[model samples]
Target: MPLHKVININSSTTIFLWKITESFEDLFDEVQLKDINLIRLNTMKSELHQRGFLSVRKLLSHCGYTDFDLIYDQSGKPYLEDGKHISISHSHEFSTIVLSDQNIGIDLELVKEKVLRIAPRFMDISHLDNLSEQDQMKKATIIWGIKEAVFKLKNEVGISFTDHIFEDPFLLSDKKGTAKLRFNEGVEQFTIVFEEIENYMLVCALKDE
Candidate 1:
């Protein structure tokens, strides 16, 4: 599929989403992968994961970048050669990338009832009260994405989503919220914005400045 959407979060930040509808062979033939990445792709055990990985390269190409322009740190966080901060995420059929002058993280997740079942393990369950079953799942997914995004932004060791991250109360109608990470003997706040795309929830997080 072509580019699904582009979200300009601010003058300096943007999000690009791609809905994967092509075959692995097609995507594989289209992208120019670095040698190491080519080996990595061939070693992937799942075809779905391989497709997701290539779809991200497609998105990079859309943004005037290639696999050669991307690199990962020892912590596994991705970086662009041009000095722009970037975050990448993909779930099922959707993949997304966020670019900003400041550090940022983005998450794309499929909405599933399983999140509600395990909410207590990672988030405050009370926030799900008084909401319908569907909204409960949606909210839990958003909160999970928030934690993942913050973790990606920090890229630090010893951060536990259940123990160190907390989300403030926010209604589903708000489409945005705030969270905090109490780690490394200090507390840092983050601003998050989320939207529903098809059956997935896409969330982007950045440190509060």
Candidate 2:
């Protein structure tokens, strides 16, 4: 499955992972080509599996974050040097990272048939029944991304996606909505936004706590 190419919103902090639709390799200067080393490439491949991480780095530079002051924490969780809350996610053909003053999580998924194969694993029975035939594939992808984002936000809180499924009904409308994500502890609320980008779907979760 592939993501449709479209910019959804004006995120104060966002990094869209373009599918390298055409290998804009020509966009780079000769100097950049010379700097490519096997070691650097391997690190990114391991961290992001050779998807769109290089583009993410380019966007980060454009966003004025040149420090590259990020590191994996003791729990193997990734964080930033300036103490800014951070979240990173990459799947299949795309990868995106978001840095924000507030805790944030983002996920992008290709809206396709593969979701049907794995639908039972992540989505509960009720969610599947709620989908309409017209955009069921697109709607299904949204739920997956939403749960992934919620898990990223609460990983520190020690909850898994299976138990802490989003309580609010899945809203696949173009507009955004708020939802409750919880497992055992008090409910943790998040603002959920679903955006249709090309053929892919993205769901972002920003926690207010």
Candidate 3:
């Protein structure tokens, strides 16, 4: 399928989402990959992942970019040649990219029952209190994405989801929240926005400035 959705988070930030319905060959034939990325693509063992990677390239094309315009830093954070900050994420059959003039991170997660089972490990379990099992799963997934997106934005080592990131309680209906990163003797605030996309949670984090 073509670009599934385009979300204008603000005047300066935008998100593009793609539903991965094409086979690996279809995606690979559509996008040109840099030599290094070509090797990385071929080395991937999972075909689903390969398709996801190429799907990201397809998304780049939608934004008037190619694989050559996308580069990664030493910490494996992606950036655009035009000096825009970009964050990439793919889960199950969905892939998304968010671009902003400011620091940003994004995460896409398929809602699953397993998140509730392990909620205690990474989040404040009290946040899940008094919610239905289904709601618990969705909230847990959102919190996990919150931590993951924050980590991607920071891209620093030794940041633990359970230890360094804290998410404020929010109802599933709110569709937005806030979090704090208490690391390196500093406290950084983030504004979080999320949405439900066909049983998947698409979460974005931006530095509160």
lDDT of 3 by residue, 1-209 (tens): 99999999999999999999999989988999999999999999999999999999999999999999999999899999999999999997999999999999999999999998899899989998898999899999999999999999999999999999999878899989999999999999999999999999999999999
Q: Candidate 2 lDDT, tens digit per residue, 108-177?
A: 7878888877767777647667567647777678877888888777676666566666636655665476
RMSD of each: 0.7, 4.7, 0.6
TM, every model:
0.99, 0.74, 0.99
Task: Give every collision pair in model 3.
Answer: none
Q: What is the C-alpha local distance difference test score of each model?
A: 0.95, 0.62, 0.95
For candidate 3, report its TM-score: 0.99
Candidate 2 runs further than 4 Å off: 1-40, 43-48, 92-94, 130-134
- What 10-residue stretch in candidate 2 is worst by lDDT? 26-35
Per-residue lDDT of model 1, residues 1-209, tens digit only = 89999999989999999999999999999999999999999999999899999999999999999999999999999999999999999999999999999999999999998998899899989999999999999999999999999999999999999999889999989989999999888999999999999999999998998
